[model samples]
Target: MLSPRRLAATAALLAALTAGVLALLVTAGLITFGAAAVTVAFLVTLAALAFLVLIVRRLDGKAHRIDLRIKKYEAELARTTTALKNIETRLDLLVQAVEDSAARRADDLGAILASLGEDRVNAMARAREVEELRAEVRALARDSV
Candidate 1:
Protein backbone atom coordinates (compact mmCIF):
# COMPACT_ATOMS: atom_id res chain seq x y z
CA MET A 1 0.00 0.00 0.00
CA LEU A 2 1.11 3.50 -0.68
CA SER A 3 2.01 5.46 2.42
CA PRO A 4 0.10 8.64 3.20
CA ARG A 5 3.30 10.61 2.65
CA ARG A 6 3.79 9.17 -0.80
CA LEU A 7 0.19 9.85 -1.70
CA ALA A 8 0.48 13.41 -0.49
CA ALA A 9 3.74 13.95 -2.33
CA THR A 10 2.19 12.68 -5.54
CA ALA A 11 -0.82 14.96 -5.01
CA ALA A 12 1.46 17.97 -4.42
CA LEU A 13 3.48 17.25 -7.53
CA LEU A 14 0.30 16.94 -9.57
CA ALA A 15 -0.98 20.21 -8.18
CA ALA A 16 2.26 22.01 -8.98
CA LEU A 17 2.12 20.71 -12.50
CA THR A 18 -1.47 21.78 -12.80
CA ALA A 19 -0.67 25.27 -11.58
CA GLY A 20 2.25 25.61 -13.90
CA VAL A 21 0.15 24.49 -16.84
CA LEU A 22 -2.69 26.85 -15.94
CA ALA A 23 -0.25 29.73 -15.51
CA LEU A 24 1.32 28.97 -18.82
CA LEU A 25 -2.10 28.83 -20.37
CA VAL A 26 -3.02 32.16 -18.78
CA THR A 27 0.20 33.79 -19.96
CA ALA A 28 -0.46 32.37 -23.35
CA GLY A 29 -3.88 34.03 -23.12
CA LEU A 30 -5.76 30.73 -23.37
CA ILE A 31 -7.54 30.65 -19.93
CA THR A 32 -9.52 33.68 -18.72
CA PHE A 33 -7.95 35.85 -16.03
CA GLY A 34 -10.35 34.98 -13.13
CA ALA A 35 -10.14 31.20 -13.67
CA ALA A 36 -6.35 31.18 -13.35
CA ALA A 37 -6.49 32.77 -9.88
CA VAL A 38 -8.95 30.16 -8.61
CA THR A 39 -6.80 27.40 -10.10
CA VAL A 40 -3.69 28.69 -8.39
CA ALA A 41 -5.47 28.91 -5.05
CA PHE A 42 -6.66 25.31 -5.34
CA LEU A 43 -3.16 24.14 -6.24
CA VAL A 44 -1.62 25.95 -3.26
CA THR A 45 -4.04 24.20 -0.85
CA LEU A 46 -2.49 20.90 -1.94
CA ALA A 47 0.66 21.66 0.07
CA ALA A 48 -1.23 21.58 3.39
CA LEU A 49 -2.97 18.38 2.38
CA ALA A 50 0.42 16.92 1.51
CA PHE A 51 1.75 17.82 4.94
CA LEU A 52 -1.24 16.17 6.65
CA VAL A 53 -0.61 13.01 4.65
CA LEU A 54 3.03 13.00 5.71
CA ILE A 55 2.04 13.22 9.37
CA VAL A 56 -0.40 10.34 8.95
CA ARG A 57 2.31 8.23 7.35
CA ARG A 58 4.68 8.89 10.24
CA LEU A 59 1.98 7.86 12.70
CA ASP A 60 1.38 4.70 10.72
CA GLY A 61 5.03 3.64 10.93
CA LYS A 62 5.08 4.18 14.68
CA ALA A 63 1.86 2.22 15.02
CA HIS A 64 3.37 -0.69 13.15
CA ARG A 65 6.41 -0.73 15.42
CA ILE A 66 4.22 -0.58 18.51
CA ASP A 67 2.10 -3.44 17.22
CA LEU A 68 5.18 -5.61 16.76
CA ARG A 69 6.32 -4.88 20.30
CA ILE A 70 2.91 -5.75 21.66
CA LYS A 71 3.03 -9.10 19.90
CA LYS A 72 6.42 -9.84 21.39
CA TYR A 73 5.18 -9.07 24.88
CA GLU A 74 2.13 -11.23 24.37
CA ALA A 75 4.31 -14.17 23.40
CA GLU A 76 6.48 -13.65 26.45
CA LEU A 77 3.40 -13.62 28.67
CA ALA A 78 2.24 -16.91 27.20
CA ARG A 79 5.61 -18.47 27.81
CA THR A 80 5.68 -17.25 31.39
CA THR A 81 2.23 -18.61 32.03
CA THR A 82 3.17 -21.98 30.67
CA ALA A 83 6.27 -22.11 32.83
CA LEU A 84 4.25 -21.21 35.90
CA LYS A 85 1.81 -23.98 35.18
CA ASN A 86 4.66 -26.44 34.93
CA ILE A 87 6.05 -25.28 38.22
CA GLU A 88 2.66 -25.61 39.84
CA THR A 89 2.39 -29.14 38.52
CA ARG A 90 5.71 -30.04 40.04
CA LEU A 91 4.73 -28.50 43.35
CA ASP A 92 1.52 -30.46 43.43
CA LEU A 93 3.41 -33.68 42.88
CA LEU A 94 5.80 -32.81 45.67
CA VAL A 95 2.94 -32.09 48.07
CA GLN A 96 1.29 -35.35 47.22
CA ALA A 97 4.51 -37.22 47.86
CA VAL A 98 4.92 -35.56 51.22
CA GLU A 99 1.38 -36.41 52.19
CA ASP A 100 1.89 -40.03 51.27
CA SER A 101 5.06 -40.16 53.32
CA ALA A 102 3.29 -38.59 56.29
CA ALA A 103 0.50 -41.15 56.13
CA ARG A 104 3.00 -44.01 56.10
CA ARG A 105 4.80 -42.56 59.09
CA ALA A 106 1.51 -42.30 60.95
CA ASP A 107 0.83 -45.97 60.32
CA ASP A 108 4.27 -46.87 61.59
CA LEU A 109 3.73 -44.76 64.72
CA GLY A 110 0.46 -46.58 65.41
CA ALA A 111 2.24 -49.92 65.24
CA ILE A 112 4.91 -48.68 67.63
CA LEU A 113 2.27 -47.49 70.10
CA ALA A 114 0.55 -50.90 69.99
CA SER A 115 3.83 -52.66 70.70
CA LEU A 116 4.51 -50.28 73.61
CA GLY A 117 1.07 -51.10 75.07
CA GLU A 118 1.92 -54.82 74.98
CA ASP A 119 5.25 -54.12 76.68
CA ARG A 120 3.48 -52.08 79.39
CA VAL A 121 1.08 -54.95 80.10
CA ASN A 122 3.96 -57.40 80.40
CA ALA A 123 5.81 -55.12 82.80
CA MET A 124 2.75 -54.71 84.99
CA ALA A 125 2.37 -58.51 85.30
CA ARG A 126 5.99 -58.85 86.35
CA ALA A 127 5.54 -56.08 88.94
CA ARG A 128 2.54 -57.93 90.48
CA GLU A 129 4.54 -61.15 90.81
CA VAL A 130 7.35 -59.34 92.61
CA GLU A 131 4.89 -57.70 95.04
CA GLU A 132 3.39 -61.10 95.89
CA LEU A 133 6.84 -62.54 96.65
CA ARG A 134 7.60 -59.63 98.98
CA ALA A 135 4.29 -60.12 100.82
CA GLU A 136 5.17 -63.80 101.40
CA VAL A 137 8.50 -62.82 102.89
CA ARG A 138 6.81 -60.30 105.25
CA ALA A 139 4.33 -62.98 106.39
CA LEU A 140 7.28 -65.31 107.29
CA ALA A 141 8.94 -62.49 109.20
CA ARG A 142 5.78 -61.91 111.19
CA ASP A 143 5.44 -65.63 112.01
CA SER A 144 9.06 -65.68 113.33
CA VAL A 145 8.32 -62.66 115.52
Candidate 2:
Protein backbone atom coordinates (compact mmCIF):
# COMPACT_ATOMS: atom_id res chain seq x y z
CA MET A 1 0.00 0.00 0.00
CA LEU A 2 2.99 2.34 -0.38
CA SER A 3 2.56 5.30 -2.72
CA PRO A 4 4.85 6.21 -5.65
CA ARG A 5 6.29 9.24 -3.82
CA ARG A 6 7.33 7.10 -0.82
CA LEU A 7 8.76 4.32 -3.00
CA ALA A 8 10.83 6.77 -5.10
CA ALA A 9 12.26 8.47 -2.01
CA THR A 10 13.13 5.07 -0.50
CA ALA A 11 14.78 3.81 -3.68
CA ALA A 12 16.83 7.01 -4.11
CA LEU A 13 18.05 6.77 -0.52
CA LEU A 14 18.99 3.12 -0.91
CA ALA A 15 20.99 3.90 -4.07
CA ALA A 16 22.83 6.70 -2.29
CA LEU A 17 23.50 4.42 0.62
CA THR A 18 25.00 1.72 -1.62
CA ALA A 19 27.20 4.26 -3.38
CA GLY A 20 28.36 5.69 -0.08
CA VAL A 21 29.13 2.23 1.31
CA LEU A 22 31.18 1.33 -1.76
CA ALA A 23 33.09 4.64 -1.66
CA LEU A 24 33.83 4.07 2.04
CA LEU A 25 35.10 0.59 1.28
CA VAL A 26 37.34 1.97 -1.51
CA THR A 27 38.76 4.53 0.92
CA ALA A 28 39.55 1.57 3.11
CA GLY A 29 41.27 -0.10 0.10
CA LEU A 30 38.44 -2.57 -0.71
CA ILE A 31 36.65 -1.86 -4.13
CA THR A 32 36.93 0.25 -7.32
CA PHE A 33 35.07 3.61 -7.78
CA GLY A 34 34.12 2.79 -11.40
CA ALA A 35 32.24 -0.36 -10.35
CA ALA A 36 30.60 1.50 -7.51
CA ALA A 37 29.33 4.29 -9.82
CA VAL A 38 27.94 1.74 -12.27
CA THR A 39 26.07 -0.05 -9.51
CA VAL A 40 24.71 3.28 -8.24
CA ALA A 41 23.41 4.25 -11.72
CA PHE A 42 21.65 0.88 -12.12
CA LEU A 43 20.02 1.17 -8.72
CA VAL A 44 18.85 4.72 -9.40
CA THR A 45 17.32 3.65 -12.74
CA LEU A 46 15.51 0.71 -11.16
CA ALA A 47 14.13 2.94 -8.42
CA ALA A 48 12.88 5.51 -10.93
CA LEU A 49 11.23 2.76 -13.00
CA ALA A 50 9.49 1.26 -9.96
CA PHE A 51 8.21 4.70 -8.99
CA LEU A 52 6.90 5.31 -12.54
CA VAL A 53 5.12 1.95 -12.50
CA LEU A 54 3.48 2.70 -9.19
CA ILE A 55 2.20 6.06 -10.46
CA VAL A 56 0.76 4.41 -13.58
CA ARG A 57 -1.03 1.79 -11.50
CA ARG A 58 -2.55 4.45 -9.27
CA LEU A 59 -3.76 6.41 -12.30
CA ASP A 60 -5.30 3.27 -13.79
CA GLY A 61 -7.28 2.62 -10.63
CA LYS A 62 -8.60 6.19 -10.65
CA ALA A 63 -9.62 5.83 -14.28
CA HIS A 64 -11.53 2.62 -13.57
CA ARG A 65 -13.47 4.23 -10.74
CA ILE A 66 -14.32 7.20 -12.92
CA ASP A 67 -15.54 4.90 -15.66
CA LEU A 68 -17.76 3.05 -13.19
CA ARG A 69 -19.30 6.29 -11.91
CA ILE A 70 -19.94 7.49 -15.44
CA LYS A 71 -21.70 4.25 -16.28
CA LYS A 72 -23.90 4.44 -13.20
CA TYR A 73 -24.99 8.02 -13.95
CA GLU A 74 -25.65 7.11 -17.57
CA ALA A 75 -27.98 4.31 -16.51
CA GLU A 76 -29.79 6.57 -14.09
CA LEU A 77 -30.29 9.21 -16.77
CA ALA A 78 -31.66 6.61 -19.16
CA ARG A 79 -34.18 5.45 -16.59
CA THR A 80 -35.31 9.01 -15.91
CA THR A 81 -35.73 9.66 -19.62
CA THR A 82 -37.89 6.56 -19.97
CA ALA A 83 -40.06 7.63 -17.07
CA LEU A 84 -40.54 11.06 -18.59
CA LYS A 85 -41.59 9.50 -21.87
CA ASN A 86 -44.18 7.34 -20.13
CA ILE A 87 -45.63 10.36 -18.37
CA GLU A 88 -45.81 12.23 -21.66
CA THR A 89 -47.68 9.35 -23.27
CA ARG A 90 -50.23 9.27 -20.48
CA LEU A 91 -50.77 13.03 -20.75
CA ASP A 92 -51.32 12.71 -24.48
CA LEU A 93 -53.96 10.01 -23.95
CA LEU A 94 -55.73 12.15 -21.40
CA VAL A 95 -55.78 15.12 -23.77
CA GLN A 96 -57.24 12.99 -26.55
CA ALA A 97 -59.97 11.72 -24.27
CA VAL A 98 -60.92 15.25 -23.21
CA GLU A 99 -61.12 16.37 -26.86
CA ASP A 100 -63.31 13.42 -27.82
CA SER A 101 -65.73 14.07 -24.99
CA ALA A 102 -66.06 17.72 -25.99
CA ALA A 103 -66.78 16.77 -29.59
CA ARG A 104 -69.47 14.26 -28.55
CA ARG A 105 -71.16 16.87 -26.37
CA ALA A 106 -71.19 19.35 -29.26
CA ASP A 107 -72.78 16.79 -31.58
CA ASP A 108 -75.49 16.05 -29.03
CA LEU A 109 -76.26 19.77 -28.65
CA GLY A 110 -76.54 20.22 -32.46
CA ALA A 111 -79.03 17.31 -32.74
CA ILE A 112 -81.22 18.73 -29.99
CA LEU A 113 -81.28 22.17 -31.66
CA ALA A 114 -82.31 20.66 -35.02
CA SER A 115 -85.12 18.66 -33.44
CA LEU A 116 -86.57 21.77 -31.75
CA GLY A 117 -86.52 23.67 -35.05
CA GLU A 118 -88.46 20.86 -36.81
CA ASP A 119 -91.12 20.69 -34.09
CA ARG A 120 -91.72 24.48 -34.27
CA VAL A 121 -92.18 24.37 -38.04
CA ASN A 122 -94.64 21.40 -37.87
CA ALA A 123 -96.82 23.16 -35.24
CA MET A 124 -97.19 26.28 -37.40
CA ALA A 125 -98.23 24.22 -40.45
CA ARG A 126 -100.89 22.29 -38.59
CA ALA A 127 -102.44 25.50 -37.25
CA ARG A 128 -102.69 27.02 -40.74
CA GLU A 129 -104.36 23.92 -42.19
CA VAL A 130 -107.09 23.87 -39.50
CA GLU A 131 -107.91 27.50 -40.11
CA GLU A 132 -108.44 26.90 -43.82
CA LEU A 133 -110.81 23.94 -43.15
CA ARG A 134 -113.00 26.03 -40.81
CA ALA A 135 -113.33 28.86 -43.39
CA GLU A 136 -114.53 26.36 -46.05
CA VAL A 137 -117.14 24.90 -43.73
CA ARG A 138 -118.51 28.36 -42.92
CA ALA A 139 -118.94 29.26 -46.62
CA LEU A 140 -120.70 25.95 -47.45
CA ALA A 141 -123.15 26.38 -44.58
CA ARG A 142 -124.12 29.90 -45.80
CA ASP A 143 -124.74 28.64 -49.33
CA SER A 144 -127.03 25.88 -48.03
CA VAL A 145 -129.05 28.42 -46.01
Candidate 3:
Protein backbone atom coordinates (compact mmCIF):
# COMPACT_ATOMS: atom_id res chain seq x y z
CA MET A 1 0.00 0.00 0.00
CA LEU A 2 1.18 3.48 -0.72
CA SER A 3 1.95 5.69 2.26
CA PRO A 4 -0.26 8.76 2.81
CA ARG A 5 2.43 11.13 1.60
CA ARG A 6 2.97 9.17 -1.59
CA LEU A 7 -0.78 8.92 -2.22
CA ALA A 8 -1.17 12.66 -1.74
CA ALA A 9 1.63 13.36 -4.20
CA THR A 10 0.04 10.99 -6.75
CA ALA A 11 -3.36 12.68 -6.34
CA ALA A 12 -1.86 16.12 -6.87
CA LEU A 13 -0.07 14.98 -10.00
CA LEU A 14 -3.25 13.45 -11.48
CA ALA A 15 -5.22 16.61 -10.74
CA ALA A 16 -2.61 18.77 -12.47
CA LEU A 17 -2.63 16.45 -15.48
CA THR A 18 -6.44 16.57 -15.68
CA ALA A 19 -6.37 20.37 -15.59
CA GLY A 20 -3.75 20.51 -18.35
CA VAL A 21 -5.76 18.16 -20.60
CA LEU A 22 -8.92 20.17 -20.02
CA ALA A 23 -7.16 23.44 -20.81
CA LEU A 24 -5.79 21.95 -24.00
CA LEU A 25 -9.28 20.80 -25.05
CA VAL A 26 -10.53 24.34 -24.55
CA THR A 27 -7.68 25.88 -26.55
CA ALA A 28 -8.40 23.51 -29.43
CA GLY A 29 -12.02 24.72 -29.56
CA LEU A 30 -13.32 21.23 -28.73
CA ILE A 31 -15.09 22.39 -25.54
CA THR A 32 -16.14 25.65 -23.98
CA PHE A 33 -13.60 27.22 -21.54
CA GLY A 34 -16.25 27.59 -18.82
CA ALA A 35 -17.21 23.90 -19.03
CA ALA A 36 -13.54 22.91 -18.94
CA ALA A 37 -12.99 25.05 -15.86
CA VAL A 38 -15.91 23.47 -14.03
CA THR A 39 -14.78 19.94 -14.97
CA VAL A 40 -11.24 20.62 -13.75
CA ALA A 41 -12.56 22.06 -10.50
CA PHE A 42 -14.68 18.95 -9.90
CA LEU A 43 -11.79 16.63 -10.63
CA VAL A 44 -9.47 18.59 -8.32
CA THR A 45 -12.07 18.47 -5.55
CA LEU A 46 -12.42 14.70 -5.96
CA ALA A 47 -8.65 14.25 -5.80
CA ALA A 48 -8.48 16.35 -2.62
CA LEU A 49 -11.22 14.24 -1.05
CA ALA A 50 -9.36 11.06 -1.97
CA PHE A 51 -6.15 12.41 -0.46
CA LEU A 52 -8.00 13.23 2.78
CA VAL A 53 -9.45 9.72 2.91
CA LEU A 54 -6.01 8.18 2.47
CA ILE A 55 -4.66 10.35 5.29
CA VAL A 56 -7.47 9.36 7.66
CA ARG A 57 -7.00 5.67 6.85
CA ARG A 58 -3.22 5.93 7.39
CA LEU A 59 -3.70 7.64 10.76
CA ASP A 60 -6.21 4.99 11.84
CA GLY A 61 -3.81 2.21 10.86
CA LYS A 62 -1.01 3.88 12.82
CA ALA A 63 -3.23 4.23 15.90
CA HIS A 64 -4.19 0.57 15.70
CA ARG A 65 -0.55 -0.57 15.45
CA ILE A 66 0.42 1.61 18.42
CA ASP A 67 -2.39 0.10 20.50
CA LEU A 68 -1.25 -3.44 19.67
CA ARG A 69 2.35 -2.64 20.60
CA ILE A 70 1.26 -1.16 23.93
CA LYS A 71 -0.71 -4.28 24.81
CA LYS A 72 2.22 -6.55 23.90
CA TYR A 73 4.65 -4.49 25.97
CA GLU A 74 2.31 -4.57 28.94
CA ALA A 75 2.08 -8.36 28.83
CA GLU A 76 5.85 -8.69 28.64
CA LEU A 77 6.27 -6.35 31.60
CA ALA A 78 3.85 -8.40 33.67
CA ARG A 79 5.73 -11.59 32.91
CA THR A 80 9.02 -9.98 33.81
CA THR A 81 7.64 -8.78 37.12
CA THR A 82 6.35 -12.23 37.97
CA ALA A 83 9.71 -13.82 37.15
CA LEU A 84 11.55 -11.30 39.32
CA LYS A 85 9.24 -12.02 42.25
CA ASN A 86 9.89 -15.75 41.94
CA ILE A 87 13.60 -15.17 41.89
CA GLU A 88 13.41 -13.02 44.98
CA THR A 89 11.48 -15.70 46.85
CA ARG A 90 14.03 -18.34 45.94
CA LEU A 91 16.89 -16.10 47.02
CA ASP A 92 15.29 -15.55 50.41
CA LEU A 93 14.89 -19.29 50.98
CA LEU A 94 18.50 -19.91 50.01
CA VAL A 95 19.77 -17.30 52.44
CA GLN A 96 17.75 -18.82 55.29
CA ALA A 97 19.12 -22.26 54.56
CA VAL A 98 22.68 -20.94 54.62
CA GLU A 99 22.16 -19.21 57.95
CA ASP A 100 20.69 -22.34 59.53
CA SER A 101 23.58 -24.47 58.32
CA ALA A 102 26.12 -22.00 59.71
CA ALA A 103 24.44 -22.07 63.09
CA ARG A 104 24.53 -25.88 63.21
CA ARG A 105 28.20 -25.93 62.23
CA ALA A 106 29.05 -23.47 65.00
CA ASP A 107 27.34 -25.65 67.56
CA ASP A 108 29.26 -28.71 66.41
CA LEU A 109 32.56 -26.83 66.63
CA GLY A 110 31.83 -25.66 70.20
CA ALA A 111 31.12 -29.22 71.37
CA ILE A 112 34.35 -30.54 69.81
CA LEU A 113 36.40 -27.77 71.48
CA ALA A 114 34.83 -28.50 74.87
CA SER A 115 35.70 -32.20 74.57
CA LEU A 116 39.33 -31.36 73.68
CA GLY A 117 39.68 -29.07 76.75
CA GLU A 118 38.42 -31.82 79.09
CA ASP A 119 40.87 -34.31 77.60
CA ARG A 120 43.79 -31.88 78.16
CA VAL A 121 42.93 -31.37 81.85
CA ASN A 122 42.67 -35.14 82.46
CA ALA A 123 46.11 -35.71 80.87
CA MET A 124 47.74 -33.14 83.19
CA ALA A 125 46.25 -34.81 86.29
CA ARG A 126 47.60 -38.26 85.24
CA ALA A 127 51.08 -36.78 84.72
CA ARG A 128 51.14 -35.34 88.25
CA GLU A 129 50.21 -38.72 89.84
CA VAL A 130 52.99 -40.55 87.94
CA GLU A 131 55.63 -38.04 89.19
CA GLU A 132 54.56 -38.52 92.89
CA LEU A 133 54.88 -42.34 92.64
CA ARG A 134 58.37 -42.06 91.15
CA ALA A 135 59.57 -39.83 94.06
CA GLU A 136 58.24 -42.29 96.69
CA VAL A 137 60.00 -45.27 95.01
CA ARG A 138 63.35 -43.37 94.92
CA ALA A 139 63.22 -42.41 98.65
CA LEU A 140 62.47 -46.00 99.78
CA ALA A 141 65.41 -47.36 97.72
CA ARG A 142 67.86 -44.73 99.23
CA ASP A 143 66.85 -45.58 102.83
CA SER A 144 67.39 -49.31 102.30
CA VAL A 145 70.80 -48.71 100.72
Candidate 4:
Protein backbone atom coordinates (compact mmCIF):
# COMPACT_ATOMS: atom_id res chain seq x y z
CA MET A 1 0.00 0.00 0.00
CA LEU A 2 1.28 3.43 -0.95
CA SER A 3 1.66 6.17 1.64
CA PRO A 4 -0.85 9.05 1.51
CA ARG A 5 1.79 11.48 0.22
CA ARG A 6 2.72 9.17 -2.64
CA LEU A 7 -0.93 8.48 -3.48
CA ALA A 8 -1.71 12.22 -3.56
CA ALA A 9 1.25 12.89 -5.82
CA THR A 10 0.15 10.14 -8.22
CA ALA A 11 -3.40 11.51 -8.31
CA ALA A 12 -2.18 15.03 -8.99
CA LEU A 13 0.07 13.78 -11.84
CA LEU A 14 -2.81 11.89 -13.44
CA ALA A 15 -5.09 14.94 -13.22
CA ALA A 16 -2.41 17.21 -14.76
CA LEU A 17 -1.82 14.76 -17.64
CA THR A 18 -5.53 14.56 -18.42
CA ALA A 19 -5.92 18.34 -18.38
CA GLY A 20 -2.89 18.74 -20.69
CA VAL A 21 -4.38 16.29 -23.19
CA LEU A 22 -7.73 18.11 -23.12
CA ALA A 23 -6.03 21.50 -23.60
CA LEU A 24 -4.10 20.15 -26.61
CA LEU A 25 -7.31 18.84 -28.18
CA VAL A 26 -8.87 22.29 -27.79
CA THR A 27 -5.81 23.97 -29.40
CA ALA A 28 -6.12 21.60 -32.37
CA GLY A 29 -9.71 22.72 -32.94
CA LEU A 30 -10.90 19.16 -32.09
CA ILE A 31 -13.08 20.03 -29.07
CA THR A 32 -14.67 23.33 -27.97
CA PHE A 33 -13.03 25.26 -25.13
CA GLY A 34 -16.08 24.85 -22.86
CA ALA A 35 -16.14 21.06 -23.40
CA ALA A 36 -12.45 20.77 -22.69
CA ALA A 37 -12.80 22.73 -19.48
CA VAL A 38 -15.70 20.52 -18.31
CA THR A 39 -13.77 17.33 -19.09
CA VAL A 40 -10.75 18.60 -17.16
CA ALA A 41 -12.95 19.48 -14.18
CA PHE A 42 -14.46 16.00 -14.12
CA LEU A 43 -11.04 14.35 -14.26
CA VAL A 44 -9.78 16.47 -11.36
CA THR A 45 -12.87 15.63 -9.32
CA LEU A 46 -12.26 11.90 -9.80
CA ALA A 47 -8.65 12.28 -8.71
CA ALA A 48 -9.76 14.16 -5.57
CA LEU A 49 -12.17 11.36 -4.68
CA ALA A 50 -9.47 8.73 -5.05
CA PHE A 51 -7.22 10.72 -2.74
CA LEU A 52 -9.98 10.95 -0.14
CA VAL A 53 -10.62 7.19 -0.28
CA LEU A 54 -6.97 6.42 0.25
CA ILE A 55 -6.82 8.73 3.26
CA VAL A 56 -9.92 7.20 4.82
CA ARG A 57 -8.57 3.66 4.36
CA ARG A 58 -5.25 4.60 5.97
CA LEU A 59 -7.02 6.16 8.95
CA ASP A 60 -9.15 3.05 9.39
CA GLY A 61 -6.12 0.80 9.48
CA LYS A 62 -4.49 2.97 12.17
CA ALA A 63 -7.66 2.88 14.23
CA HIS A 64 -7.66 -0.93 14.11
CA ARG A 65 -4.07 -1.08 15.37
CA ILE A 66 -4.86 1.30 18.21
CA ASP A 67 -7.85 -0.79 19.24
CA LEU A 68 -5.71 -3.94 19.40
CA ARG A 69 -3.17 -2.17 21.62
CA ILE A 70 -5.89 -0.99 23.96
CA LYS A 71 -7.21 -4.52 24.37
CA LYS A 72 -3.73 -5.85 25.18
CA TYR A 73 -3.22 -3.20 27.82
CA GLU A 74 -6.54 -3.96 29.41
CA ALA A 75 -5.65 -7.66 29.71
CA GLU A 76 -2.34 -6.85 31.35
CA LEU A 77 -4.02 -4.54 33.83
CA ALA A 78 -6.43 -7.29 34.85
CA ARG A 79 -3.61 -9.74 35.50
CA THR A 80 -1.77 -7.18 37.61
CA THR A 81 -4.89 -6.54 39.65
CA THR A 82 -5.36 -10.22 40.37
CA ALA A 83 -1.73 -10.60 41.47
CA LEU A 84 -2.09 -7.67 43.85
CA LYS A 85 -5.16 -9.22 45.42
CA ASN A 86 -3.29 -12.47 46.05
CA ILE A 87 -0.40 -10.63 47.69
CA GLU A 88 -2.80 -8.75 49.93
CA THR A 89 -4.42 -11.98 51.07
CA ARG A 90 -1.07 -13.56 51.90
CA LEU A 91 0.02 -10.50 53.87
CA ASP A 92 -3.16 -10.61 55.90
CA LEU A 93 -2.55 -14.24 56.80
CA LEU A 94 1.03 -13.46 57.84
CA VAL A 95 -0.11 -10.63 60.09
CA GLN A 96 -2.69 -12.84 61.80
CA ALA A 97 -0.07 -15.53 62.49
CA VAL A 98 2.30 -12.97 64.04
CA GLU A 99 -0.42 -11.62 66.28
CA ASP A 100 -1.37 -15.07 67.50
CA SER A 101 2.26 -15.91 68.36
CA ALA A 102 2.62 -12.66 70.30
CA ALA A 103 -0.52 -13.40 72.32
CA ARG A 104 0.79 -16.84 73.28
CA ARG A 105 4.14 -15.39 74.42
CA ALA A 106 2.37 -12.79 76.55
CA ASP A 107 0.34 -15.49 78.30
CA ASP A 108 3.46 -17.51 79.02
CA LEU A 109 5.17 -14.44 80.57
CA GLY A 110 2.17 -13.83 82.82
CA ALA A 111 2.26 -17.41 84.15
CA ILE A 112 6.00 -17.14 84.89
CA LEU A 113 5.51 -13.89 86.85
CA ALA A 114 2.72 -15.48 88.94
CA SER A 115 4.95 -18.44 89.83
CA LEU A 116 7.77 -16.09 90.92
CA GLY A 117 5.36 -14.18 93.18
CA GLU A 118 4.34 -17.42 94.94
CA ASP A 119 7.98 -18.41 95.50
CA ARG A 120 8.71 -15.02 97.15
CA VAL A 121 5.79 -15.46 99.62
CA ASN A 122 6.97 -18.95 100.60
CA ALA A 123 10.51 -17.64 101.31
CA MET A 124 9.14 -14.91 103.63
CA ALA A 125 7.18 -17.48 105.69
CA ARG A 126 10.30 -19.67 106.16
CA ALA A 127 12.34 -16.67 107.41
CA ARG A 128 9.75 -15.94 110.13
CA GLU A 129 9.74 -19.57 111.32
CA VAL A 130 13.54 -19.60 111.67
CA GLU A 131 13.43 -16.44 113.82
CA GLU A 132 10.87 -18.01 116.19
CA LEU A 133 12.98 -21.18 116.62
CA ARG A 134 16.10 -19.12 117.50
CA ALA A 135 14.24 -17.20 120.26
CA GLU A 136 12.99 -20.44 121.85
CA VAL A 137 16.53 -21.89 121.97
CA ARG A 138 17.82 -18.79 123.79
CA ALA A 139 15.07 -19.02 126.39
CA LEU A 140 15.98 -22.70 127.13
CA ALA A 141 19.68 -21.77 127.60
CA ARG A 142 18.74 -19.06 130.15
CA ASP A 143 16.78 -21.58 132.23
CA SER A 144 19.68 -24.00 132.24
CA VAL A 145 22.04 -21.29 133.42
* Per-prediction TM-score to the true structure, in the order listed: 0.64, 0.69, 0.70, 0.80
| Candidates' C-alpha lDDT | 0.88, 0.86, 0.88, 0.88
- Number of the top-ranking candidate, with TM-score as the measure: 4
Q: Backbone clashes per model, in order?
A: 0, 0, 0, 0
Please identify which of the two predictions, 2 or 4, would achieve the higher lDDT against the true structure.
4
Candidate 1: 10-residue stretch with minimal lDDT? 42-51
Off by over 4 Å in 2: 115-145
Give the candidate order by descending TM-score. 4, 3, 2, 1
What TM-score, to 2 decimals, does candidate 4 have?
A: 0.80
RMSD of each: 5.1, 4.5, 3.5, 2.5
Model 1, 36-134: lDDT tens per residue?
988777757766776777788889989999999999999999999999999999999999999999999999999999999999999999899999999
* Model 3 misplacement above 4 A: 1-17, 20-39, 140-145
lDDT by residue for model 3 (1-145), tens: 8866787788778778887888789999999988987887788788778777877988898999999999999999999999999999999999999999999999999998998888889988888888888899899989999
Off by over 4 Å in 1: 1-36, 133-145
lDDT of 1 at 19: 74
